[model samples]
Every structure is written in structure tokens, then in C-alpha cells.
Target: MRPDFAASSNPDSITDSSTWEAELNLGFTQRGDKTVLVRREHRGPLTVQRPFYPEGEVCHVYLLHPPGGVVAGDHLTIVATVENDAQALITTPAAGKFYRSGGGEAQQTVNLKVAENASLEWLPQETIVYEGAQLNSSMNIDLAEHGRFIGWEILALGRPAAGEGFDSGAATLNWRISRIGRLVYMERLRLDAEAFQARWGLFGHSACGTLFVYPASSLHLAAVQELIGDEANRGVTLIEGLLICRGLDSRADLLKGFFERVWGLVRGDIVGKEVCAPRIWAT
Candidate 1:
């Protein structure tokens, strides 16, 4: 089988020697009832906007990737830490794009830590992977006892509305979650051309997503199930104290909307605060 996707980025891909390597690190600590960005370091094209306090002390931030899209040989790393009693919510202003690879793979990694009694929300927009793209992405999260988290990741295989499908290319996604110094959950997914079309795999869905909320309840699971009642291609479950939700669809926008609805339903239970969408989402 052959992949039916683009051969390179909108322009040509950069050679491995000339590829961009970017890294961003941020630290947040509680200061007088507010979480302040106490430490920041960025190299290359990655940076963040000033923090916003739309819902009181919760620090809301939007990560920015100035280069807009990634191609072969690009690597990005992000690390964020929230100190005890601090609270932070992070997101991206726009969807990330992984263009078709000329050769080597593009990679992105995220590391997050929440200290005891702290809260962190990782809610980036979905990622768009063009045909022939080779991407390796992973997220690692560590939470101390009593720390709370609500986050989601969405992947769009191709531009379905534009008549494109993931007929070629490769993607590997991984997630690691640890609480109280013990690993609680881990997942790995490898999707390729065959898996994209297989009935036992994506079954031709162009978009898929997962949402996780730590320290959840049966009632919360019930609430999410109640909201998703009878909806095909959507499911929810409670594992230990984590609530996990999954969705699949043909359009990325639709899947993202569905995840947003679920986020609204379960946020209060997970974070003790009602769903206050980051204002950046509006534009």
C-alpha cells in the first residue's frame, strides 16, 4: 500500500543538519494568592504570552510556536512546573501542524509537574498531520498526592473535508502519568497507513481524541456517560481516580467540539472550578 499524502512541507523541508531544535521551560509559584510566572527560559522559536487571570488567581497562558508548522528534522521540548498551592492553565492559540516529511521525523515532547495541593490544566488545541508526515509525540505528567489535573490531546490524521486521508505516513504517540511517585497510567499508540484504514484500528476516522481528569469520581463518570448517552464513537471510564474519555470522528473540528463539551461537564468535579474556557479559544 502507498501513502496518499504530500511529499514535503508547504515549502521544502529543511535538512536534518539545518532543522530547528526548540525548548521552553516555565515555573509557576504561588505569590500572595496568585500564581506568578517566576521562571521562564526559551530557546529558538518557542515562547508564551503574558499570563492572564480571567478567573481569579488561576494563571492562564497561551503557548506560541512562531514558526507555525513543523516539518522533517524538527524537534520541540516543553517543560512546566507548578509549585505547591499554585494553579495554572495552559493552552495554545492555534492547532499545531506537522507537515509531510521529506525524510527524517518531527518530534515534540511535553513534561509537566504539579506539586501537592496544586492544579494544572493542559489543554492544547488539536494537531493536524498531513499525509506522509512522520511524527513522534509524547507527554509526561507527574502529580504529587492531592495535586489535580485536567487535560486532553487530539489528533487529526488528514484533512477529511479537503478529501485527504491518512493513506501514508507514520505517527507514534505516548502518554505517561504518575501520582505520588508511582506510575498510574501509560499508553502508546502507533498508527501507520494500514492502521489508518483498518476496521480494527481507526476504521477510516480522520480525528481521534482522549481527555483525562485526575482525582475523579464515579459520579463524574456517570455525568460524562449521561452526557454521551447513546453517542457512537464516544466513550468514558473511570480508572482508579482518573476519568478518561475518548472520541473519534471524521472531522477534527467536530471532535474538538465534542471534547470541549465533555471538558465543561467534568471540570468542576476535577478542579473545583466551573469551566472557564481560556479567552484565547475565542479567537
Candidate 2:
């Protein structure tokens, strides 16, 4: 069955349309002493600002969705490839918003490719999904031998500060991580109204997140645990060198902050450098 998006003569144009279909493709390659964005392709509202090198040589980019929010019948895609020996970090200017939908599902897909001896960091801010919204999101990462990656996806289920809870609709998330063509970790989670209010589920928490770090050691897990030990709803574990961290909170900012702290603790081990906070984050 086909998705119900209206036919458009121009694939990149959203003129007079109620729904949007957008995609962005980014490629980074090492040149001389620096990593550079060599490829950037986009359609519709999805695009990126010029690459920033606040730390020098390491390319940092901010994704932009000009419409500011996604609603029913919208589809978005983001793909990034880091060539051999290159390093890049990708983030968004602010939290993404998936507004309430009347019926159809809004979809977002992300694909990340890290080549041999390369490093890529995916650290977008939290996504805010409003009440009555239907969202389906997926992220897949493929890494070659000697490649490294650290990434996280934080989600805010509803506008907690606005007294809105995700009482209706659903969001499904899927993640796949593979190395050298071998699939290692795969997961799928579906959240609906029942799960939102259930003690076994979120138990009224409005925000949740998962952070993944490749090439991690048991020591890294211990260090992260030391940061999360005081929080009852935060946890970390190591599986086949992949360190997975999870957290839940009533506010999205809190959950995002916790992940940032965890990232700061392990970034040096993962990337051989300490965290250089993105300047756009403070603005």
C-alpha cells in the first residue's frame, strides 16, 4: 500500500501542499588536515547550515527544518556518510517538534555510514512529540572495522510544561547498529496511550532517551554508571563493546542534559578528545 501523500510534479517543491516530504544527504571526507562536507543534497524543508569547525578539523553541522514542525502525512529523511579518516558531528539547532496529527502517520528515517578509521557523532537535541501525534522514526548505523560512533536520540512524549501528556496516538522507534556488514544490535519500541500511563512503561515520565557508544569498554560502562548512580530512572550497560545508556525524566531538557553529561564523560575515550560543546547550543 502506498502512503497517502498527494502527487507532486516537483519532488522538492511543497507549494500549496498540506504535507511535506523532505530529505537531506551529507557526506564528509578528509582533506589534508581537516574533515570537510563534500556532499550536501536536500529536498523540501530539510537542509543544513554551513559546517562549523569550533574545535578545528572536526566538522560540526546543524540540521535545519525550516517548517519547524512535522504534522500528519509528513516524511523526512537524513543520511550522512563519513569517509575514511574523517570525523564529523551532526546536531540540530533546537529540539524537533512533531505536532498533533489528525489521522495519518509522520515518518522520519536516518541512515549513518562510518568508513574505516573514521568517526561520526550523532547528537541531535531532543524531539518533542505533541499529544495526539503519530510518529514513526528509525535510525540505522553501519560501521566498518576501526570506525567509531557515539550517538543518542532523546524524545519528549508531550508538552509537560504546558500540562499536556501523550494521552493519545502513538510513536514507534527502531534502531539498528551493525559493524563490517555484520548486524549486532537491533531494537523496536512502540509507545501508545496505555504505555504512556502504565507503571510498567513510562509511568508518567514525559521524556526518555537512549545513548549508544561503539568501541566502548567495561570501564566506560562503569564511568557512566558513576554518573547515573544517583538517578533511579537512569541505567547503562555494555553489550559486545557497545555501551547503551537509558534515562527517563519528567522534562525533556533534564533528560537531554543527563545525556550530555554522559557524553562528556566518555567522549575522550571514544573519540580521543574531550567534548567541545556546540556553540549553537547556547544561542
Candidate 3:
């Protein structure tokens, strides 16, 4: 007999849920010799993709490995810091998928900090939420003066390929981006299965992603619009050098592909890279 799969009122209370945390600190200083320092600490069983830039340069690190793949009551935390003049790019090996839990809820928290004139990219792999799963996630970022950061989060509510179309599950996401202790942008999205499937909400789509580009400039604005022109299903906004791009899709891969394109454009124009495909991303 198959087990019952239904939404529970208290998903966070399940006893079997797992927990995990990972922290990485990157520092760069010009002390007669230009060198980069990396300190990584892992407290639990999490696999990391390792940070890799072109030509094997360590721009940033990508950490993976979920404590326990999003079972009911699971909690996960990821903390990262980049010191002054440090440049890093972080990305997951693949999409982070959350399976349905029998009982409680699953939650994840991410915190990122970039010092003055430092550049950081928090481009994790996309996240897919299965039916009957309840998830709440938040991402908070702090940047200093002249700090540059690029971040992206993609969420897929259900497996549309298997005939699942967000008919189940609940997700709440909160994100805030700030620089020099000043708020730049803040937004939240709370979606239930029904609301997510509404023609107007996700417009019956199963996947969506948000890309944030900070400390916006006029050139960046024009470049972003040129890159995202007339994508009917996506939305774009500019706020204080922060470009926000949101896209809705029924296929998970579509979201990933879209993000890759956006990343390439932004990196080339803003980050001074002709090709931003990190070596680890291709691996």
C-alpha cells in the first residue's frame, strides 16, 4: 500500500527532518603581494561544488550537499563573506530539488556579505519543490560602498513534465538587498498550490526565477533591457543600480537556460569578463 501524501498543518515539527550549515570566508589584501585567502568550515554532511573561475582562478566557492534532501522539518543555513577587493562567483552544480515530506515543513536561510570594492555573485543552482512539500526561504545581502554583487534564485513548484503543475505544495520566499546599511530593494512572495497555478499568479507556470544586479549604472540598465527585450513571460525593473528580472516557465530547464544567458550578459558588461562561464559550472 502506498503511504498517504497530504499537506500537514505542522510540517516543521517532524522529528526525522535533518539540519545542515556551511560557511565560507574569502579575503583579499594587497600586502606587497596580491594574494587571496579562503577559509572554509563545514559542520555537517554537505557536498560542495568548490569555487572555480576561468583559468582555474578561485573567484568564489560553490557549496552543495543538503543536510537531508528537504524532508519535513528540515533546516539549512549557508553563510558567506567576501572581504575588501575580493572577487568571487558562487554557483551550485545543479538545481537543488526538494522532495515531498510526509509531515512537517522545510526551511532554508542564506546570508551574504561583501566588503567595499568587493564583488560577489550568489548564483546558486535553481530549486525545485515537489508536490506536498512546504518550504520557506530567505536571502539577505549586505554590501559596502562600491561593492558589486549579482544573485539569482529560481524556484520550480512542481514537475510539469510528469503532469504535475503546482497543484500541491506551499512556498514563501523573502529577499532583501542593501548597500552601506541602506535598503535598496525588499520583496516577498507567498504562494499556495492553488494560487501558484492561477492564470495570473504564475500564469499557470511551474517555474520562476529572480535575478538581482546591484549598484546599477546607466550602461547596465541599457544592457539588461537589450538582453531581456520583449520576453512576454518575464518582468524587469531597475532600482538604484539593482536590476531585477523575473521569469515564469512550465519547464525547469527553461529557467536555468534563461539565467545562464542573463549571467553571461551581465558578467561581460559589468564584471569585465568576456565569458563568465565558471570552470566549475561546466564540470
Leading candidate by lDDT: 2
What does candidate 2's lDDT look like per residue over 1-283, in tens digits? Answer: 2222223222222222388899999999999999999999999889999999999889999999877777778899999999999999999998887777777899999999999989999999888887888899999999998899999999999777777788898999999999999998999999888998899899989898999999999899899988877879999999999999998898888888888999999899878889998998899
Ranking by TM-score: 1, 2, 3
Error of 2 at 4 (Å): 22
Candidate numbers, best lDDT first, in rank order: 2, 1, 3
Q: Model 2 scores what on Cα lDDT?
A: 0.89
How far off is residue 204 in model 1, in Å?
Answer: 0.9
lDDT tens digits by residue: candidate 1, 1-283: 1121233333334334456889999999999978999888999888999999999899999999877778788899999999999999999998898887877899999999999989999999989988888999999999999999999999999877677788889889999999988999999999888998998788999998899999899998888899899989999998999989999898878888998888898777666789898888889
Local accuracy by lDDT, each model: 0.88, 0.89, 0.70
TM-score of each: 0.94, 0.93, 0.84
Model 2 stretches with alpha carbons more than 4 Å out: 1-17
Q: Give the residue spans of candidate 3 off by over 4 A.
A: 1-37, 47-50, 56-58, 66-68
In angstroms, give how far residue 172 of model 2 lies from its true place: 0.4
Q: Residue-wise lDDT of candidate 3 within 67-163, one digit each (tens)?
A: 3256656567777787776677777766675667665677788888888877777877778787777888989999898888888988988777667
